[model samples]
Target chain A: MSNTADPVSYLDYQGRHKGILGWILSTDHKRIGILYMISMLSFFGVGVILGLLMRIELLMPGMTIVTPRVYNSLFTLHGMIMIFLFIIPGLPAVFGNFFLPLQIGAEDVAFPRLNLASWWIYMLGAAVALTSLFVGGGAPDTGWTFYVPYSVRSGTNVTLAVTGAFILGFSSILTGINFITTIHRLRAPGMSFTRMPLFVWTLYSTAWIQILATPVLAITLLLVIAERTLGLGLFDPAKGGDPILYQHLFWIYSHPAVYIMILPGMGVVSEIIPTFARKDIFGYKAIAISSLLIAFVGYLVWGHHMFTSGISDTARWIFSLLTFLVAIPSGIKIFNWVATLYKGSIDLRPPFLFTLTFIFLFSIGGLTGLVTGALATDVHVHDTYFVVGHFHYVMFGGTGMAFLAALLYWWPKMFGIMYNEKWIWRSWAFIFVGFNMLYFPMLIQGWMGHPRRYYDYVPRFHATHIVATVGSWVLVTGLLIFAITLFRSFKSRVPAPSNPWGGRTLEWTTTSPPPLLNFTQIPTVTRGPYEPAPTPTGGETS
Target chain B: MKEQQSLSYGSYVLVWLALVVLTSVTVTIAGMHLGALSIATAIFIALIKGSLVVYYFMNLKNEDVMFRVMLLVALVTLTVIMVFTFFDISFR
Candidate 1:
């Protein structure tokens, strides 16, 4: 069956509800995934603007545009919005929700209604997060980490802000449950675990992390709320509670949450690299198992963040070793990608270019992470701009780049339309250059003794800060251009071909945008996800 | 697909009642000023209630072996995290 042969696509399907309600009320997984994408991008734009405003304020260091308090609030809101709304749910919620069923040869997630409920819960959480800004005294002034004493003493809407986080945790946990159950129960006949795609493997690992680690964040955020309203003093020092314990609880989840953010990005890279390389992925079992290993090891390594926070030396050293150990699996995946590309017909399309950059940038992010992971070295640079630089390199560079790659790679399939390649290339160049200029200086400035979350830096940091600010401008311009390309695709009358990129996964088997039932006839899989390429002699070569 | 197993309504009610009573016990121990015992006792009661729900309300008893193993894995992972936290606390 041609996956796109049906005239009424999910996008155009006329359900019982009319227009807007038809979308909002529909329990279709694809519809929910699209809802998540539209709303998250709108919020991402808001987050990016907040970041730009912060960069502008840091342009000259001394009260450039906004006051110090406004700067603090800006970074706080920026962190909350980006982490909660965008990054944590980054690929899994958007792509996983949209394509998981199609890739697995199922109609929808195990619990389709629960899938829709998750979107509603996410929106409610977003509403509650934004409400914290307008409702109480003011926006949360304490940083997004919400360290104990300051979080407890801050007069701003810390409780409401964290309550929003608490609610968002529910949505995360629900999605995790749905994904795990879906994977376990719904694979098509003859499609065993090994036959699943790498993206599904990463999503499976991410789902487990979501289930396990998120409860800690939920409980931690709730404790913050309890401390604020009920005077529980669970993390307050003067109130007989230990603040270090709070850091422990917070990082316990936040660290694994990083994997939740990046693992799917890794999964996306795993998919794109093979498709563009036009060959079987190198080390399929290794990459799949590595995803789970990252999730597992990532959980125990949170103590690296607590190195300078007065944790015991034994705990600190063990954490440092585990931190280094976790790097092995990440390195494994990168090597596998490179090995897959070796001697293959490499297509340097927009998506492949973004994936190539993801490897480069994420490698930087991962290496510098080792610097901070070392106990002795971490003592010198904990909470410094080095930490900030390291974070962005992986986060914005790694996951962020992967997100762009995934969008470009899948947009043809998702919306059944293609973007202007010229703009896509231009935007990619600007983003790559501007991203380095933006965050790399922070690494140097951090090394030179500039602390993060500070409104103003000393005159020594003035030059690097200016470079970063200008870089932010370039980055935003690139993003805006990229956004325009996507919007322009809506006006194109030509529909994208069913298999735009000659993808090997089941998602590519159907039309660009598959119909209501992803496969009218269920597929029976007999081989692995990626097939070995054919040699000129007509022999199957691995 | 799992074969539908008939779960008795009375069994579900008993499990629900057990949960409500255990919640009251958790509250009672909290008010009893048991200090360290309060949290420990509360957690013990909570586990019992969770197990009840898992076996009864969730119908985990009749689900596939893979489902039980996955549940076991989640619990083992949680236990590892908790043990690590206590490891830090005990050492420090």
Candidate 2:
């Protein structure tokens, strides 16, 4: 169905309420997913501008633009905005809310009202964080980590930010609980766990992490609030509280929070690769189990982040060892994706191109993670640009590319219109190239002991800093083109085929921009998600 | 709901009695201050009480394997984290 198709889709489901109210008040998971997308992208735009400002300020190294104080607030806000607002909730809330039920052949999530409540809670949290910028002191300057002493002592609005994050954690937990219940109770009669799509599997694992791990963050942030207001001695050294305990609690959630950010992206890649490759996924069980394994091992590795904070040497060793082990499941997933591409009909579609880029970029991110995971190297690179580059590669590159891939992969299904292929490829090239150019030099400079979060740098680091700044310009342009081209497709509004990518999942069985209840009749999925397809001998044969 | 079973008031009383006995034993052990053994003993007793609540009071015994496994996984995760944190503090 087109946007103006005969059938009444979710876009018009809330006929009683018109415009924004209809969207905000509707309980349709699909509509809720769209609401999340719009709100998150708006926040993303703010984060992008903040990132660009930081890059501009860092261009010449010696107070080129903003002062050190402003730079501190900028980075802090950027981190808080990107991590809490965009990345962590990015895939699952937007795509997961939209597709999880459809993929499992359900009418909607088990709790549609609860699902809507999550979106509202998320917006409320995000608004609270952004509001911190205006009142109760300027935006938090303790950086997003909000390490104690300074966070407790700072005159800025650390309390509001931390409380915002606390509320957001609840939102995350609610979504997690809803997804868990939905997956367990709402799967169609014949759609067994193994028969579910990899996307659903990743969401399932991520939901567990969200439910269990997010509370630690909620409590930790509440402790920060307590420390800020009630003079709680929980994390303050002056009051006999160890600062490292803050680190321990923060990473306890934040580390698995990493998986919360990346796992869904991995899921998107899992879905995209098979569709583009025209082959059943290789080692499906391995990929599915690895998602769980990663979530399991993910909890133990939070200690690695505290190694340099003067945690015990034995703890360091244990954390380091566990960190290496966590990489195994991650490696298993990467290997399976690569193996799936082998001896197959690989289509170099925009979505596939983005998926391939995710593999390359995420590999760099994942490997560099090892460097940080190890004690010796991490000591040298702990607060350096190396850590910055590594995280961006993983977080931005990995999740960012997957987000784009998911956007492209599901765009037709989402809007019932096909975007221009030429612009899609062009945008992909710039993003891939510009992304590397932007972040890669940070690694080199960081390796050279160039510290991060510093407004002023020595003359020696200026060269690399300039290159990264220039790369930021290119990256921004590419991102602009990506957004514009996709948005422009609405003008022509060409109707999309139900199974545009020849996807085997239940989502593909429904109409593009599916109808009010998703399916006229719920599908009883007899076949596995990725059934085998003929190996096409056309362009880009793998 | 299909697995729901009728429980006599006497069984509830027995579970409550067992919990009380375990708590007093734990308290008496704590009063003795048997070095590291005191903490270990207290924790062990707490685990027994917790299991009894889960199995009987919570009716996990009659629940599906899936529910049991979910509970086990959560408990195991919590145990691992707590033990590891204590390991870091104690050993180093």
Candidate 3:
């Protein structure tokens, strides 16, 4: 962006083909990252619309718009799209791919061709997932967890859907392997493990979870498919299998999958807080190590999901304790972030503001998570709307907020464009209010003993459902405006600075839209990632 | 990486004593009938002993910090899972 007449960035560079084909076939990490961004936003839009329809159907209760069977399919597809398609692969596939190599001062990932393959595999997986909706018995009606017995008996296309999830897991695993190798082997000279950016640290930790745990998910899904098609007895009680074991394996990966959904967002906020707060991070070692600890400790707590399934009291209480342990690392991150913001030259910019929202909402999600983790409380709210609200607050409020922050923080750098600040603020107001308005009601109604995934709720639950549906309208309006602002930025003459946010990371060293090989010359990082440059604007600073 | 430290025979004996004490603490906690805390405490003690064996006897202490950290992560996760499953089967 510093160049008056734009230099050749990854955007302008061409390879074997022209235009879209060039982009698809390109091995460039940045191009693949852009492809992921475009694809994820498309899926997110569909997921949101599905969610909106579900909210509307719930607004008045008693078959307002959809049949009970149709409602079941809607929620199932919504969860599958949002989780497998958007959030799980969200940050790492998009921002991580784009920024990881850049921050570590590598030209591209360690496996560039493999990086391209991961995206291709992702598309194939997505195609398989989407195909299930149209073919066979229409969409799957078993809620996304695909709880067995029910999953085994459902006439809808559970097999195709589970197979799609299994393929998506392969894509996730390959991406994890690519990121791990790139981080370990490609850090620039003097950029020791301690010197890499916090985002890189989070990616490193997340990649391990992806590779280590995702295979369990693949195996679990495959078993579901095998049961549906081959009549396997691994999960069928009559054939001598316990259905409880299925929940164990699913959550074993899926709970850590929750951390995978969250950790990168933590990483994004870590970058945003230091840059906007205008101070080095507080407790860098703690934040860095906690990322790993969350990934590690996350595996111990999956059994809390199975308390009502008769998995024995011993497994129940032990899981409850380990679930509480997760709060420690999560709390460490929250405290360290707050300390970073305290008494610093704070700038309430777009990214940092998004981060503030994340902290508030995710804290609610975390504390309520404690309520959900306790054996006493969990038994009451296991399938209730309170559980639904807690999940949304964590996944959508926590991960979704951080995803917005990452978009705002990197939009300028990624494409050499900056969004209108005034519009961004207007959108943020609606989004922050609407997100809480929609999800908070679910918590209250859920506590009133309202169950989730039901076509008709008792009349007592109608008020909160209406409130949530209206909130969805407001939230969608905000998102539309936010999208418009970014679209409008492409034409604005406002030049993006090479280092727009005055970020200390290596990505700030090059042109705003970085060249084919990220840096003109690879940067040698001497100080810790957040350390300010010596003598203002020397090497590694614009 | 720093120079790897080798322990003297006295240090090894101290480690062995600590492991023995941790094992007894587990037995004592179980004897106290601390209910859920008993399982948690026993697992905690088991983790400590397992860490000692891995860190000292297996020479994980001399390797890279990431390796030791990784091993501890793996050991802690697997031990809890294995023990938790054991309790589930035993109680049934």
Candidate 4:
């Protein structure tokens, strides 16, 4: 059946409209993906600036640059921008919006208008978050996690930040609903669930996490804003509200929020590894089920983040065990990727290089995560740089690397222009090396009893602080190389091919910078995704 | 593919009525101050409401086998998250 005759088409496809007005007012998934990319990159820049300031201030320590209050705002802004504005929305809204439908052989997401609305809502939320800088009380000082009592009593603009987060949560849920519907209903003829690419399955799992967990964050932030405004005592201890409830609600989403951050990246890695290896993804069913398992286990382990917050010992132990259990599925994925690469014709392209880096960095991040997962170990490392180091490795090393890899891998397809391969590799080298230099010292400092979130530390910790600060500069330089390379590639004379990487997914079948209607005719899937090319004429796996 | 047919208006009304009744019962149960039991009742009622939304509004009831399996996977994961969270919360 043609899409025009389908009842669900209105929700699935972007109809024609003309001019700049069409882009501004349109509901196309591709346009919305571009919008998200622009907005998120802007936010990423803001976050980078915050990180730079933090590093500069920490260079010599002992109030070298900003006041303690300013330092508090700086870290808060850093955490807020990185977590909420950049990482959480990072891949899904950009890559997921652009590629999820394509991977599944659909013309567009299930709800295209809603997809556009998600971007606008995200922009609105970002405006609210950014407005805190100009507000009377300055920005929120409770950090991004916004633990209560302190968060309630802090002089910073908690209300605006929390409200921004609350609105953003709505955006997340809407996108989740749209993705769920699209994946379930809009697949092309013969594209069965098992035949779908692993990336689509990752997005499918991530959408559920977004739908289920975002509401908890919405409610949590609403309560925070209420306590700050309406005097709601839900998280106020003096008013008989349990402070712990705030932590519970926050982590309920925030833990799965990590999955929301990583799963799309995992999807990206899954796509990259098999394509580069020229092989089917090893144990496709296991890898797909593992995504869902991670999301499920990811939600239960939020208590581990709040381990030292004085829950009962039994609760602490339970959270610790569950936290450890969450690692299994992630481990499964890593093993599967390695297995996929085993004895295969592996291409050492920039995307594959980053994918390999992600495997290594993410493994380290996961292993160190075990240290914090232990109840006793976490009690020691709770507020230390160890936690910070662990998360940055996971967030920057894992998700950030995967994001860059996906961008490089798909840039030609997305923009119909080729990036300079040499420049891309050079940028990758700097990032890979610079990132380790930046975060690895923090692990040592953490073990040496250095706490996180401090504006100034004792002079004894200055050497390690200096090393970390210098590493930040190197990391920033590396990142700048990537940004510049991308800009140069966009402005350069190189034209892209339809499939630059010899990819196995359906997306590679379409034109580079595909037409507004993604497919002129709906494709009929004949075999499983990631099956190597040049198959026999009858569509059997030779 | 079958020709698209209009959903019976009665189905919509019945679903809305079911949702309203269930919501009322949940709120009434919440007001009873039954502690953990009240939370459990509200969650159970919310589950029913969510199911109604999924089955009717989402049209999962009429969907293909793959979709049913997908929805089942999502629900199972959702339940695991909730149950495991309660494991920690209630135990504490």
Candidate 5:
């Protein structure tokens, strides 16, 4: 039975198996990817609600909605949901799973069953994590970092939450393994590492970090559980264990986790810029190489997160220097993206708008990171709203915008339906304006010495918090419209073209909502991933 | 793809004997109380044993270059993280 001869779309494959079970049990990478997309978006919705609630609670000098205890739990849940559930697994699990095999001209990933198992594990882990909200000890208030001594002693279900994170780590590792194997063994005849798309390269680098770095997080969280249960002196001062060591172990996995979250977002941007600009990506090799460099150097800079935690002066100096080095590769990527746009036929589409917004927003995020990376500036704004603002800019503004851009970019391909252009632009406006209003003030308040996670704040910080809270409403409205627009497209009058954006990759050559076996036959590539668009017959340059 | 070698029983017995000899040597060295040198010797001995198992039993030695490099890269990454982490702890 030749797979290429099979005439069914992955969406409709095994129509005999009806309803949700088709999705839950199917091993098709595309179906699993859709499953992840639906689950991730649901969790993203939860995270956004929690975020808005936290912002509302901080709107005035005192609590506006819930008590301080509830507010504490709110922020913890928000961070836990956003980081572990949404951002870390966001791009790779959703887009990476769907596109990697397609882009590489393969039928499926190396391990389809393992891929499906990872998604189940992810849902199980998420369910376990949410259970903490109602079970023994209320939702963990130790915050997402689960800083120890407090974590070990807290009556909240820290063990369950930490266990959930550990389970999720395993999911990440398996996905990483699947991706690495698929990329290594399954590229089309002429495709080489350098010839692969930047998105694929970024996924490759991210998978490495996932496999290598996530184990440390698993062990660290397990130690947290052990400390809480077995009375291990691992990180408890009462038991003579140092709390700083816990920070070390946590950040060792986490600082790389930051890269795990952002690198794929960068890859998405790289794909968008070239297609919209109608040009081959500038500095393709440099961008691709820098991904690996960023992943490698990212591991060394985990020490920066612990500079003020009573570490030795020598370690501080070394870590501080390493932190700055990690920025160079990121800078190279940004420059190449901008350079790719220079003197090109720039299309001002919605995805292009988000890409431009990502460049602007991510730059702010990256630059502000330097301020915090410095030893002196970080000491002042370590736990302040500045760090909070900086983090949102990078995570939400950087990766979030990129995520939306990817959603917009790939929407047509995934659904075989066209979105309303006017609504797309409208959502972009609300999101762009709302995002800045929401996060920009935190930078100011943070610089003005406003601490984060405070149940209440003084009058000086109240005005900015109010602005931010108002911005949260706008951002949510924008996200609401964005979702509605995409959902409406499911019943769209016009079917999407196979290559809506004229993407110069294997995916664009196939059918929209591609068939069960990705291509009619395995593709044989002859050109770079991004080749120049053919000149019009009438001699138009663009 | 690799050609799976059918190892004779004699080779398996010889490998087993070599492992036993190494274990005995490690025990003798540990009994000598060589201080810091003992830790290094033990690690070195264990690496040899582990490599033997990986190459012979696990068949990584016969796998493609890509798999070997992947394994090497993982080992190297873990080593870098461990060594640097020790740098912080030891200096502090």
Candidate 6:
């Protein structure tokens, strides 16, 4: 053991704390991760309900159960909950917090207490956002992007929504600060930069984006709050302030915000791909470098979102090209993953299955993204279901699928419980089939001239709308089964063993449900992260 | 004993002073009528202040080579983002 003193004895004491207090007051990364998962899952369910209401309203088009006013409010709430509450904090807060230290062979994160504080801040932000529902004027209807002028003039609870977002931004920044410090200060003796796992590299890249981009969002929101409440005149057009500047500032953070959502998901895929392939990842440095490239290029492409919003023609053309250029690094990653799988021992386990599905779905998403990125095409498809389908393919199919894959891949290690493999396969099939069915119809409907964000639709769009609604039910059912499967697994009596997937990352070097101090002794890395090591004959020897 | 030695209180105070001074200068400059030069000046100062926070307050200056490289990579990426954004906006 690296720690010559009695490390196990110290950890044993930490494990014996009382139940609710143990979780509520604990600084342990594992407990904090569980807390994030629980909170995000609740948020995800709320967001999904809002989304279902949207699809139901759009099924036959013209004002089904609510007025346009209520319809606008529903979409606004859906977008805010999903983007801010679900995807922004999705994988990074859940998996990044739990696994970054473990993979780097650290005892715990550099600032354990600070980690707990970040979660409380996140919870507080969620509370503030939910409280807006009960406010006198109802919630904000300016959509989650909260563009100014309209947001400034809206009658809904803009103050409450903006404040909640501002608070969440702080929680994000704190997590970024903590991750950066831990990675810098706490790596094991021999874990060099080149020797670090791809997951850590992705987290490092993500931390940079989080720190740099989130502040822009905070300041932009503050400007909006001031304009609304204090008459700051920053985004008010009549007052000689350029409303376009508000769009620029909003997308400055919001665009990189996509990378914030996907980078950690990319980290999840990186960890999953190598273990199941049973080979060193192909072009490791290329993959690592491309991750940073994606994060960097992601910021420049925000202007593409505003092409139809009356941005200048020259600006539109520039954003168009930059948008295409940003796709290169993402393409590089896809190519490398495919090459990694070629002529290799491939496992058809649930995690690997999800990774494969992510590749296919994300490719379609990326191509559709290109269509939207093109100035000529975006004008036609802008604000249509085409854009909606494209994002859902990327965010929901790409990152959401990867999030589930990572959870299952690490569940054995995190909770020390083994789920049934049959149930895992069953749920993956339902989700994969159901998801495509749900989203695929949107592309056609959008192409057929179905405008998005409209409470009512023309009779011509009804056929595709019915199909889309049916697919959504299937998707929801699949998700329900997936949730139940996980719940049943968590309550099972059988204990899981570490290194269940024969993974080579340092996280597998410890016991399942690792101690509060993740490592008893800091590990000394001697090989590259994905180097082929002999498989353990039995399970992990902790 | 080792943990105590790692905590550098003096360095933290020094870094905070430097950051405060830099921020004040930036804000003062921003208030001036530099016309087109204002945005550039503000960003440059913010960059410097942000660097000081990373290097000293965070102790990244004394950390491992990998951390230094990571920070440098991030800085370069930040520069690229700003330059590219300017390219698009100015061309319009």
| TM-score against truth, every candidate | 0.92, 0.95, 0.88, 0.89, 0.94, 0.89
Q: Which regions of candidate 6 are displaced past 4 Å?
A: A1-17, A534-542, B1-92
What Cα-based lDDT does every candidate model obtain?
0.88, 0.89, 0.89, 0.84, 0.88, 0.83
Location of the lowest summed lDDT over 10 successive residues in candidate 4 chain A: A1-10
| Best-fitting candidate, scored by DockQ | 5
DockQ of 2: 0.56
DockQ of each: 0.54, 0.56, 0.32, 0.34, 0.59, 0.31
Better of 4 and 5 by lDDT: 5
Q: Write the per-residue lDDT of candidate 3 for residues A109-155, one digit (tens) a residue.
A: 99989999999988888899989999989899999999988999999
Query: What value does the interface RMSD of model 6 take?
Result: 2.4
Worst 10-residue lDDT window for candidate 3 chain B reads B73-82
Task: Please tell me which predicted candidate would have the highest TM-score against the true structure.
Answer: 2
Best by lDDT: 2
lDDT score, candidate 6, position A335: 87
Model 6 - which docking category? acceptable
Tens-digit lDDT track of model 4 for A359-391? 999988988999999998888888999999999
Write model 6 residue lDDT over B27-90, tens digit each, in one string.
Answer: 7897898987898899888888888877766777668677688678768756866776676556
lDDT of 1 by residue, A1-542 (tens): 22434756788888999899999999999999999999999899999999999999998868989998889999999999999999999899999999899999999999999999999999999999999999868999888898887898899999889989999999999999999899988999988999999999999999999998899999888888888889987776677898899999999999999999999999999999998898989999999999999999988899998988888878888889888988889989999999999998987789999999999999999989989999989999999999999999999999999999999988977888878888899998889889999999999998888999898878888899889999999998899899998899999735777777767888877766788878768888877888742322112111
TM-score of 4: 0.89
Stretches of candidate 5 off by over 4 Å are: A1-7, A237-240, A533-542, B6-49
CA-only RMSD, every prediction: 3.9, 2.8, 7.4, 5.4, 3.3, 4.9
**What tens-digit string does per-residue lDDT give for candidate 5 at A245-339?**
99989998999999999999999999999888888899999999999999999988888888789887788888888899988999899999989
Best-to-worst ranking by DockQ: 5, 2, 1, 4, 3, 6
Q: Under CAPRI classification, how is model 5 graded?
A: medium
Q: What overall lDDT, based on C-alpha atoms, would model 3 receive against the true structure?
A: 0.89
The regions of model 3 sitting more than 4 angstroms off are A4-7, A538-542, B1-83
- C-alpha-based local distance difference test score of model 1: 0.88
Worst 10 residues of 2 chain B by lDDT: B83-92
